[model samples]
Target: MARALDVKRLSLVRLALTSAVIVLALGGGRALAAEPERPASQPQPTPPVPAITRECQTPAGVKTAPIPLPNTLRALQQRKKIRILAIGGASTARSGPDRGGFQEVFERIIEGAIKGLDVEIVNRGVSGELVRDAKERLKVEVALTQPDMVLWQVGTSDALARVPAQEFETHVGDMVRWLRAHKVDVVLVGIQYTRSLAHDPSYQAIRRAVRRVAQREGVLRVGRYEATEALERVRQGRQPTPPDPFATTEGSYACVAQYLAQAVTLGLFARRVEPRRQRPPNPAPAPAPEMAPTPPRPLPLPPKGG
Candidate 1:
């Protein structure tokens, strides 16, 4: 009876040990299968933007603070909502509900390019006002709206009024500087060359002067003459050129306005893509070292003199 009891007891112990080993083996297999895979070495992607440096210059060759686009304008474009106040010559001012001309065309183009974007373009163009007049009226007429971007289109009237280039430059520069000081983004649209002006040396000289001022001021140029020239090229190719002597007739003006609006939309896109500046990458924290348990230290040696 004792021998039989010993055999049964040994069998029970062996069974328990086998069951525990099988469970541990199954658990180990599951853990291995569930482990996540990792790549050998992950590479970080390069940033999409190029670093931009801001700088400004004065007519007297004095350098001033870097005058880059404002962060507020960039932020607004990113949000897909931009408020634009276009103040200039007749080209910009003719878009009112009552006028129903190039302005409507520009509005349609703007709406098309920036879908779902809240864009408002207010036109305040007086028939024959020069740069000084526009600047004088801006405070009461335009500043009240507090637009994010201002398209200054006054050089045409300035040239028509025979305003000297230097005076024009000073007035325009002051207006731009003031707007910048107040954190407004200004884009200067150079004057469109008329058929009469194209042949007139004096008018051409004024156009060149306007371009110089615009460049020195760091203002974006819409290149009205180039756009008109392109349209003229297209018109020339047509066997029967239209009766209109003006390259920027109602139809041509509509086309140019559409193109300009698209250009504005692209500018807005660029603002969104790059923003004010590229932010530096955050530094990674140093990894903690794995600390192995220290072995028991040997008993301290007997006191040095002992």
Candidate 2:
């Protein structure tokens, strides 16, 4: 019986050894099949926002022309308030988001650009209006709002309407001069630039007319065309510009707002500002005539006595 028990024990121990070997083999296969151990990877750094992605993100390379926002600057200095009247054609009318449009974006940008100045922009954009219509409305609106500055978005409508370029120039010049005479500064926002219209004679002519008017008046015209074209190139991976430069995208409008804001801020702060006008000195009183009165009285009395 003892010898049988010993044989059974040896069999049981062999069975256990075989099971352990199978387990070890299976585990080794799994380890060999599994992926090898690797060094822990470092976290990837976040990429920067590209200039083309957002207008506000990039340095605008702002061209500092002499804007001389005289009244606007003066009011900002004294009253801490500056009001702007935005008058224009289609671009100004529907050139932004569905709710508030580009004017709203412009107001927020201006306010954000210049600290400690209350900037109010009133939108008086009438889509499809020519320079004549804009001028007429400007008169009434100026009388009502009495804004310190007039952001005149011109040229596009005149070009589209086939108005004579000279006539367009005349109308724009007249209004800018009128605004200046009325102590209001003018910022002429030229026509929206489109690659499609670059070759169009009428559009180019009107653009030239607007530029001439701005130059003649010595007012600031935001470089809407050039700046936007540059931005479009940057956005399109430096490819040839898109045919419709002003594709009416929210991003396009935002870029416009940024450019306009930069222009206004530079005009207000960077330019040589006009000092507050001093009152003229009072005129000197006229001198009294010298007295030969005593001698004359004596002569008259002697004649009466004789």
CA-only RMSD, every prediction: 20.6, 25.5
For every model shown, what is its TM-score relative to the native structure? 0.59, 0.65
The sequence of per-residue lDDT tens digits that candidate 1 reaches over residues 1-306 is 999999999999999999878877887556666888776876323222221111111122211222344533464546757767777766344433436445566766666654565667787767677887777787675568777778766577777667887888888889888877776787766677566678766566667776776678775556666566555655565556544433345655665565556445445434333456767888898889989999998998998888
Winning model by lDDT: 2
lDDT (CA) per prediction:
0.63, 0.74
Q: List candidate 2 segments past 4 Å from native.
A: 1-64, 91-99, 237-246, 271-306
For 1-306, candidate 2 gives per-residue lDDT tens digits of 999999999999999999878877777556655858788987433222112225534455536375667788778878878898888755443422354556677777677555655778888877788988777778999999999999887888888888999888888889888999999999987787787788999888998887788788889887666666666655666454444545555666677677677667767765475788999988888788876655544444455557
Judge candidate 2 at residue 113 and give its lDDT.
52
Please identify model 1 stretches exceeding 4 Å from their true place. 1-72, 75-79, 91-101, 237-247, 271-306
Clashing pairs in 2: none
